[model samples]
Each structure stands twice: as C-alpha cells, then as structure tokens.
Target: MARGLSQPKRIVILGGGYVGLYAALGLQRKLKGNEASVTVIDPQPHMTYQPFLPEAAAGAIEPRHVVVPLRKTLKRCHVLTARVTKISHADKCVEIEAPDGHTEQVGFDILVVALGSVARLMPIPGLAEQGIAFKTIGEAIFLRNHVMSKLDAAASTVDQELRRKLLTFTFVGGGFAGIEALAELEDMARFATRYYENIEPSDLRWVLVEAAGRILPEVRESLGVYTVLQLEKRGIEVYLSTLAKSFENGHVILSDGTEFDSDTIVWTAGVKANPVLATSDLPLDERGRLKATPTLQVEGLPDVWTAGDNAAVPDLSRIEEDPSALCAPNAQHAVRQANQMAKNIVSVLRDKQPRDYFHKNVGSVASLGLHKGVADVYNVKAKGFIAWGMHRGYHVARVPTFNRKFRVVADWLLSGLLRREVISMGQINNPRAEFDRVSRS
Candidate 1:
C-alpha cells in the first residue's frame, strides 16, 4: 500500500509488553502510507509498566495510570485482544484464541515474537493456592486490598496467635520485584497501623527469604550489603542463602530450618520464558527462548524476529568477552532491542542489512520504601532520599506516553497532599455475591 499497491505486507507482533508495544509504535511511525500492516496480538489490551507495580500496590500511584492502552497508543497498528496458541513459521501463520471462545489462524509476512516470561514456579506444596505474585496491575490492586484486609482482621481478632500470623508477611526472592514490593507494602502497613489502636508497627514481622547470598544483585555488592543493613534496621528479617521449602497451610518452612506462619506469601523469585513458545515451529534455545541473532532476527530464519525475555538475543556488548553471552532479560534491554529491531526490519524491507543490537550496562536502582532507596549509576553510588528521587525521576521518564506520564505525576502530587488510601474494597473481589443474593430475594 506504500506505493499505491494493494495487499500491504502483514507484520504480526505477539504480546503487548514493552517490547511488543514499542516495536509496534516504531513500525507504525516508520512504515508510511501502509508500507506494511502491523497487527499486535496480545491477551491484554494494555501494556503494564512493571516498575511502577510496587507503587501501585502501596497506593502511592493509581493502578490505572501504570498501564498504557495498546489501542490508544498504537493508533496506526491493529490491536487484537487474543491469545496466540501456536506459531507455524513454515506456513507463516499463527493460531489465535479469541476472547469469545473462537479460534482462528492469522497469516503474516513478517513475525515478531515478544511473548514475555511467566512466574518461575516450583513443586513447593501449597504455593499455588496460598502464594500471590506481583507482576500485573490486578495483582497490585489485589495485594493492596489484601494487606489492608489482613490488618482489619488482625485488629478485630481476639486470638493473639491469629493476630500475629496475620501481621507476619513473608516475601521470597530478593530481586527488584520482591524487594520493592516488600518495602513499599511494609511502609504502607506501618503507616496504616497508626490509625488502629490495637496494631503497632513494631508488631509486624517482615521477612525476606532469598536463595542467593546477596540481595539486589543488580547493584554493587557493597550496595547490596548496605540494602540488607537498611532493611534490618527497619526490623525486617533478611534471610540470605536460603530457600523456601514449603508453604503448606499458610505455614512457611525455609531451608535454613526456620518455620513461620503468615497469611501473605509473596512469590517473586524469578520468571521463565513463556511455555507457549514450545508449541511454535520457531527454533528455541535450551531454556525454551526463541533463538535470535545479534541483529534481533531469528537464527537462520528470514522474515522472523524476536526480542525481550522470550528471546535469547546475543549481547554483542559482551560477546567479545564471553562467546555465549546473551542480553540480560530486563526492561532496559527490551525497550532498546525493540527500537533497534524496528529499525532493522525497516532497513531489511529497503534492501539493506540489519545492524546488531549493542548497549552497555548503565546501572540499577532500587527503592527500599518512601524516601529510602539505593542506586548505582555509571559506577557512582547514592543512598537514601537522593537515590529514591533518582529512582522516581528515572521511572517517571521511562513509563511511556505523555498521557500516562502526566497521570502518574498527578497521582504522585495528589498523594503528597492526601493520606495514603488504606480502605479495602474487598467486595470488589467477589462482585457476584450481591447479584446472587438479590436474585435469591
């Protein structure tokens, strides 16, 4: 359609994550006058800004502000709210399961696989039923309400054991997701207790269990140590080099012979590539990730490209040092890779070779709680309020879309003027109850 020709090239992008959304945006901007038809297929209609999940969970920011609507953002691209069940590269088709229980196959001239990772679960007993994850906006809202409800239950309970158990919070994984969620929620809980006469901040038992020897491995070892100390100062029990063995019946049994009862068990340990890739005809690595070259193209497969967590993209910045080096699966890499992938795709369409993706590690930042954080940027370290400000400023700029950025900033400003919203609308979790009661009446 670019040159007034019919049947424009069809480019299908799987998943509406950072990689998928950004790639679609880039493609729409570059492909003028329908040079190509870009179709983005994802179960969700919006892309969740994961870095802000903790703030949303803490009620520091509204949940709605943390997600970018794909339809609104990608005005030029076709957005499909459906699950991609399988891909047949040989046939240039993908099987899609629609929301209305219908299935269909969609054909494409170029395919972009960006289906991200899912929670890396284990065989631990009771984890599936008792544990909650901190990945989505829904999970963040649920957690905020759940934590508040636990406090309400604790304040009303006469049994000391039940109250203690309700106040005990256990978080597994010391990574950004786990640590940030734990810190933010803990801060919120501490603030919420000021209104309850029966509850006190000192009564809360916050525990962090990590299998590795250190937390915040993204930062320097010294900074990681400092983070542990800061958390310890806040009365949080930091368990390093420990594994969560079992979580049966709200009872947590750790590898280090520590046992505790808690109502909340947050699992943010790690994530693995989406299992949906196994059904695809595309070549995959041992870890079940799509095998991609330095230029973001699928290995030995033309017209197919991959990026993000599900793609084993060669890290050219590290390949000279380590031949097997692959890009670290993070938002920073996903975003940059997506932009480069789009450029490469356009270049290929114009009869040119694609360039390899390369970028050096800038650094990492982690917020312990409000007004408390640690950051290592370009080999320089900062701690406390300054680091926290840097964390917020960096994320606020990277959250995508001017509309979303304005909304998020407004939420932050309003939160400063008003107290944190601790009210738990638990009934939202069971909306059918009222309807059922009315029907029976």
Candidate 2:
C-alpha cells in the first residue's frame, strides 16, 4: 500500500511479459501519487524482449541486454517475483506461490489477467528430455553454447557416425521464432566453422521441419515462398508439410518416412495459453483463453480484464470479414491492447466508460540472418538486406525504454567492430563442479 493514501485502490497485474509490463508502466504514468496502488506479480523478475532472442543467440546482441528488470523498470509499481497459482475473481483474491515454496493469498480491487502463453508441447517421446526449446533468453543462450559445443565435439571425434550426428542441427517449426533462430544460428555456425581447423561449412547440416504447407503464415504467401527459396539456397533443407513423429534417442523420425540421427533438436512449434488459467474462476473459451470483449474487458465480469496471448480478444478490425475473428496473439496486438487497457482502467476509476480497442494490421518483418530478411509493410514487400534493416530498425524502436534501446544499438555497433563470440561457455551449466573438485583436492 502507498503511504498516506488511506485504503488506496489496489490494482494487480499478472505476468511480466509485454502486456503486464506495459500495463504497469501505463498505470504508473496515469495514476496520481498514491491514488492507486499497483502490484505486478510474475515468476521472473525481468520481462524478456522476445523479438531479440534470436539475435542474442546468434551473437548479434548480448544476452543480458534482452530483458528489463521489472523492479528496476517499474519504479512506482510493486513488483512481486512469484507465480500466480490460482485466480478467484469471484472473491477478488489470488493465490500465489513464492520462490521459497510458500503459498499466500492477496486481495485486489482490480485485476488484470495477462498471464500470457507457454510452449505448446506434444506427447512425442524423448522430446521432454532431448528436444531443446527456443523460447526464453536462457534457452537461447543454452542453444548457442550447445551448438558451438557440438561443433567442438565434432572436430575432436574421429568416428564418421559420431561426427555426422554431432554436426547435424534440426529445427521444428516455420514461424518467425523457429525460422529466425534457425537461420541466425546456422549463419553463426557457418561463420564459426572458419575458426575450427577440422570443421568445414559443408560438414554442418541444418534442417527446418514445418507441418504446415508453408512457413511464416503471418506474412504474404509469396514472401513466405521467397523465404523458403532463400533458405534452400544456403543449403538449409526446408521440410514443408512434414511432421516430426519421434525424436527418441537422438534419432529423428518424420511423417514423410525420413529418418536421421541428430545431436541437436530445436522445438518452436507453437504456444498455448498458460495452464494456470484452468484453475481460475474466470470464464475461458474452449481453447483455454479468457473470453474478453473488444474493449479488453472480461465478458460479464466487472473490475477484471485480460489481454495478450491468454485472452481471446475479438478482432474488431476484422469483424466485417469474419464475425468470429479474434486478435492474433502477437506482440503488436499485445502492446496496443496494454495501452488501451490502461486507459480504460483509468476511465473506470474516474467513473467514465471504456472504449473498444481497434487497430489495423500494419505489417510483419522477419530477419533470416545477418544482412538477410523479408518484410511486408502495408502490402509493400521487401526482401534481402532492406528487409533485414527494417527488421532491426522496427524492433529497436519498440524494445522498451531508451536505456535498453541504447544498449541493444551499442551491441550491434560493437559486433561490427569485433568478431562474433563462438567460444562455448558450457561450464556455466555446472558452476559448483569446480568448487567441489577443489574442496575434494
């Protein structure tokens, strides 16, 4: 509670992704001193700028610069690093599990459900144990080190079979994340091979598997086709309409009856709403997303709102074309929705009615690798270096605070002056091992 504000209006924002972070920022800006107390609860202390994860993994940007610390960023808002276990909207309270494994309940006058989504995993065997994800900053860093380590292993191995498996990298997905990560890391690996005396570029195998007929459905089909061609030109095998049947014991079995042994399997298939929503009393759609109105309010639920990947917000911009159309769960929509949601919350506080959220589909841009990309803005298509420039330019402009923007830009400038770091710091995974060894000695 804010000091000197007797019984300050409590406003709680869930999750620390694009929606929650921006909403908290908006509230802090709009609310007067001690007018409303804001609390943001998330499992992590920092909010990741997900769009830059690929670049970070590829050594284009430093990993630590890709996330904003919630506590440091939201100065006026109370930031709690905890997982929301249950949301009882009816009772106007939420149950949270702290980092220390303690559960506690907190009451809120207003609630914002922005729990976001989680990686959608399948029942594929060995995936849980073997397949690495390309979602978080940690995963990106891990994959970078893991990929380089594989090359090191391949260089040292004399066995042909072992070398072949060690040099193979398989990516499962065709979306922006999957494509960008695969392309960027592949470019990195190709460049890094020049430093390794035994490893040649041709020795590395990069494969992309997408169950869909085409990749990058967010962009125009023609652009997507062009992307596929560009990828294939670089010796990347694009498997369209192919499913990864099993990844058991480093052996990849595809629905196309293709079988291969790989040491690295990257999964970026899709994402589903956070499973915690299942325990909430709020109304949810069949797909587990919260039912939200165009105004970003939960239907028939006062003082409660939802947005981002976890809410099925009606797409007013597409209602004429498709009456049942819902907003695409992307950062573009999430940012805009958070701004509008904050405005609406302020309106309700002042006894004013809220307005609906409507934004036209601007465009989409994707970076294939350094100096390579494809973009479509307002039906205008751009490919190659121009698109890559646009991709970096657009993201830098939207990547949160000016402090972070400066650091990310500085990283890009520094990368131009220095060589890409390819050394695998795999030892970071087991920091205590050295201490244990020294203690025993």
Which number leads on lDDT? 2
Model 2 segments more than 4 A misplaced: 1-6, 437-441
For residues 31-108, write the lDDT of model 2, one tens digit per residue.
988568999999999999999999999999999899999999999999999999999988889999999999999889
Candidate 2 pairs with clashing backbones: none
List the lowest-lDDT window of 10 residues for candidate 2. 1-10
**Measured by C-alpha RMSD in angstroms, how accurate is candidate 2?**
1.8
- For residues 248-310, write the lDDT of model 1, one tens digit per residue: 999999998999899999999999999999988889999999999989999989799999999
